[model samples]
Target: MTQRTDVVVIGGGQAGLAAGYHLRRLGVEHVILDAQTTPGGAWQHTWDSLSLFSPARYSSLPGRLMPVQPGRTYPDAAHVVDYLADYEKRYGLPVQRGVRVCAVHRDGAFLRVRTDCGDWRARAVIGATGTWTRPFLPAVPGRREFTGRQLHTVQYRSPNEFAGQRVIVVGGGNSAAQIAADLAHARIDLTWVTRRTPRYLADDIDGRALFDAATARRRALDEGRADTGGVASLGDIVAVPPVRAARDAGLLNPKPMFSRLTAAGVEWADTTAAEVDAVIWCTGFRPALAPFAALHLRGSRGRVATDGTRAVDEPRLHLLGHGDWTGPASATLIGVGRPAREAARQIRDLLA
Candidate 1:
């Protein structure tokens, strides 16, 4: 049997849930399809020690605030997972779990979302599948030739496995810093490498500050004002407690990116080489738009050209929570609400 919904939201993460909340508020009938068997979305798979850069109050969805964790300033991943599960239940959002959407294709006037369980025909589709599942590993020479164990940010968990082993952590972003901090005491030898010198935000700055700056920049751009650098002008890495402690202790030493990976380890342009046990690539992720491949909507940048959240070529499609391309700070828990609301409003109008 073919299921029919007014809107079909792909991925029941923070983004999908936000979209569902708004759609329901606007009286738009919709169903969210999630690949995970349970709630929490990407938060379920994050490292055990991962903590939000801000307090629970700053990291929340629309219509509800995340509860504060007892004795914790920044909520951990498990707390976030609990909040998401509770959020879904509280709102009675229509989310079908364990339904892996294969592709979305046009069926006359409606879009058919083909999944493993069944088919759903929707007037509009919201692509809220965040980049967690699609971890990116940069192509470095001799990567395949390296005999050392290799992994990406997604595969990383606690740092116990690397104990008494030499490890090289790659990337200049927050993940690299956090993971390096996690492994600081766990590993006997650790090397953190980045494309450039890692930039750290002021100790007092966190996600709330970043989100507000992004919003201001977004407003300026929308109002035809000069481009303020916004968050980009600030810094790359947030000086979270753990990161700050690690940096102060002189444990998080970042070196320039290696020239190539040898059979045993990484080699720099200076011909200096380091033998290591493993390499963790924190290079980040690309948008997970594989299901929309048939639409041919992505451009050379591997992004769907959009005016706000709506796709230019395919007006029926809205890309939500991917990144800034979808909306300013759209990928964060606090940031996704704005785009989700805008997407829902556009969807409501489209249906009308």
Candidate 2:
């Protein structure tokens, strides 16, 4: 007999765990299926030296606080995993690890989720898989001809791996900056490539009253009325102090954007080419919703179409950990809790 649940949540990352916890609190019957052998999805795969830009106070999940040493800046990736493990144990959230959902289809009034382990039937599904599953690499010319060691930021672990090698980092995101800086300390000759100069911000911008003001500016921009001419980027709005400190330590300089990836490394738009021994693509990620292509997505830029908290096309499906849910707070760990709770309530009501 196929296992049945009122709700089936894909991916046991922060968002999925939070959704499961909220559902359990509401006395709803549900199951969480994750692809990994353990919890804390992307956190488990992060580089060894990675620490959240958000401080411990801001990284807590619902009903739990991320442990931290007093006066410490932020917890490392391992600490995050430990906290997630503890969260699961404390709440007794029903999660099935090592279960990768291959496909999801509508079966009568229910959804059928087929996993490597078994088939699951649910009245609703939450695509809490998060966005990090798919890494976005630009289709530059001659990329396949490059004979050098090429790796995406997802596979990157530490600078020690690239010691004594000339490395080229691509993209203008936080990961690109942090990886380039980390590699610089190892005395590796590194060059950063970006199409546009990435706007860098200090990591302490979360505390300022101006931070709230900037959020208002972001909302206006989202509505397409006003341009965020002088407003800071998301990186600038969230945490700027640590980023500034990294820059002061000579780790945050911008390079012209990527033009091509050649056998001799990367070529920039300015026609400057370097013979890099390795290339690290710190390019961003895309949502992993291809498994549910039947559901017509409604958002701009291929993101799931949702109005505030409700999904437009599929009422039974919801998204978490999306950028800027309720203002800027939606991007952080704390932000997902409210939305998770609201989604859980809606799921419960639908089942009733």
TM-scores for all candidates: the values are 0.99, 0.88
**Which candidate wins on lDDT?**
1
Task: Go through the candidates in order and give each one's C-alpha lDDT.
Answer: 0.94, 0.75
Which candidate comes out best when scored by TM-score? 1
Off by over 4 Å in 2: 207-246, 296-301, 325-331
lDDT of 1 by residue, 176-223 (tens): 999999999564488999999999999999999999989989999999
Clashes of each: 0, 13
After TM-score superposition, what is the CA distance of residue 11 in candidate 1 from its true location, in Å? 0.5
Assess candidate 1 and give its TM-score to the true structure: 0.99
